[model samples]
Target: MRKSIIAAAFASLAILPAAASGAEEPPHVDYSFAGVFGTFDPVQLQRGFQVYKEVCAACHSLKFVAFRNLGDAGGPHFTEAEVKALAAGYDVAAIDNETGEATTRKGLPSDHIPAPFPNEIAAKAANNGSAPPDLSLMAKAREGNASYIHAILTGYDHPVPEGVQVPEGGNYNPYFPGGVIAMPKPLSDGQVEYADASVPRTVDQYAKDVSAFLMWTAEPKMEVRKRVGFGAILFLGALSVLLYLSYRRVWRNVDH
Candidate 1:
């Protein structure tokens, strides 16, 4: 009986890892690279802008990006005049003379973008005791950018087995910083429509586009880096070919 019990215990241990692996969730998504153009898709950027303006802007903030930057790489719908006008809409930071305190004055080239809330405490108080995280560096901050966005937007799925609960007026998402979050999934199928027929109006499509845009917001100069690398590679390849031909000519008189 003792030997039989020991054998049973060993069998259970052998199956444990496989069982755990089967129960584990899928891996996160990544969105660090660009598609075929070696640059961002203007259409996707425009769509992402629309989603940000319509859905995300009210809660989250894009403190890192300037309106003027939108005109780069042929961003759709926003012109230079419009970007300048848009950037000028808000008050930027300045020094307050009466109290000798640095405060926001109006929108300017020098000012850091303002936060939605004065502080984390204020943000949580406003949002049912849940703080809305700053999104300025979200793309860079998190791993697997695309997966992060997709999981976030679709985070409203069934609860985890760990007895995690989403309290009243709060939201739940598996991919959030904390497994339990207060912000609900903001997108759904056909929640918003797009004028561009090539771009689908589904929530997944919106999430992808917006995620791509945020990635760009995090690294606007990536295109330049990619272009430089490609150019260097081509130049090196040509040099290598020329060197090979020169070596053949020089060695011709050396005899085999």
Candidate 2:
């Protein structure tokens, strides 16, 4: 009789409402932009820049970037003159040697935008205990790197089935720690239009572009590395062919 009562109690508990059960699942979003793994698109990079400037800049700091670097091969592909013109809109600070003060100067190739918070202490204080990580090396620092970012961006989802138990304010993400994250999805399809028609205005397109730009920022010499690697392979292939020909010639006279 006791076992029967206990089973009935458990079955009743299982049928409780989601709120009563304190159950909610993390949001699931489709993060596969373009395909499983896609290279960076310059057209999308420009649109991402627009999104960052208009939305993300309010809370985040891209401290490592100079306005001029936007014209790099993997960047927005801004022209030299266009970059110069764009850089002119922002002011950068320099140490004034004569007065022992940091003075503001128009942004130049040498200057990086000062961080929003003076230091980590101030940054954490400003962000409700969540430190806005310096995105300078994010693409390189994280494992599975670009794919991880793409997944996280689109992982928002609705609650799980009723009666399921999920922690408060915790959303489900297979990639994030504990399947929960404090940050919400930041990109949406058509949220920001691309100035260049070559790039599609999709969430995946934006994610790929920004991720690529971040990767380039992390390793500016990547293109050069690719070129060097290709050249070496070609040289080695030619050398192998020459050696094979020489070996054949040397043995031609002796072999039956």
Candidate 3:
């Protein structure tokens, strides 16, 4: 009996590697905002916001972001009026002062983005027992960040490989862990009309744009932080040069 149990354990351990092998590494993308000097593209960020509002918002939420962030420097840079107008369209939770009862009011630029569902339980109930993750920090939280998102979004194009069995309500995506994902293919060609006529209206573009936008949401102040770091580097470099000159001058007459 003990031998049989040990054999069963070994067999399970052997299966683990095979299961893990199903998920493929996401392809690298040369995003504009990739390196130390990276900067977010305002136009792309705007388009991504549109995609999020029209499609992803139905299932996922950007609960950490606010309407005012749309107008912040180094972001989408939507005008103040536009931000206010957009905020007014959404109803946010509030409490009535007179009645002391829970209610809702039009969203304000200051308010955090509201979730599609009131809570996790409702979100799960609406999405086949699997709650769609909040996309606010998804870019930062995931292993490959934006690239992983792009891969998962476009990975649905291929048919399931042989010997793979996708469970009910689960979709096969080699980019997704365990070779299955709860969410179906969300983006399709020409699904959302782009205001910019130059950009292609395709799934790949949509995925890329949204991925960049999510990255911005994850690190809204990334540009500012980068700028500060660069400035500090310059200051330190100047200080080092000055100190070296002073040391040479001070030790010139008393050389060791």
Query: Best candidate, TM-score-wise?
Result: 3
Q: Mind giving the per-residue lDDT tens digits that candidate 1 earns over 1-256?
A: 9999999999989987546433223245444354534567777787887787678876787877766667777333367676666557767767898998988665653344456776778778888887777676687776565556656776576566567665788666656654666786788787777887776788777888888778777777777777788889999999999999999999999988
- Candidate 1 differs from the real structure by a C-alpha RMSD in angstroms, to one decimal, of 6.8
Which lDDT tens digits does candidate 3 get at residues 1-256?
A: 9999999999989887546566787889889898999999999999999999999999999989999999998999999999999999999989999999999999999988788998999999998899999999999997899999999999997788899898999999989988889998999999999988899999999999999999999999999999999999999999999999999999999949
TM value for model 3: 0.88
Check candidate 1 and list the clashing pairs.
29-147, 91-106, 92-106, 92-107
What do the candidate models score in CA lDDT, each in turn? 0.70, 0.65, 0.92
Question: Which of the two, 1 or 3, has more lDDT?
Answer: 3
Query: Cα deviation of 81 in candidate 2 (Å)?
Result: 2.3
Question: How much lDDT does candidate 3 score?
Answer: 0.92
Distance from true location, Cα of 85 in model 3, Å = 0.8
Models 1 onward score TM values of 0.70, 0.70, 0.88
Which lDDT tens digits does candidate 2 get at residues 50-109? 766655555567778877678877456788887777677677667887998988777775
Over 4 Å off, model 3: 1-22, 96-101
**In model 2, which runs have C-alpha deviations exceeding 4 angstroms?**
1-40, 95-99, 158-172, 188-193, 196-202
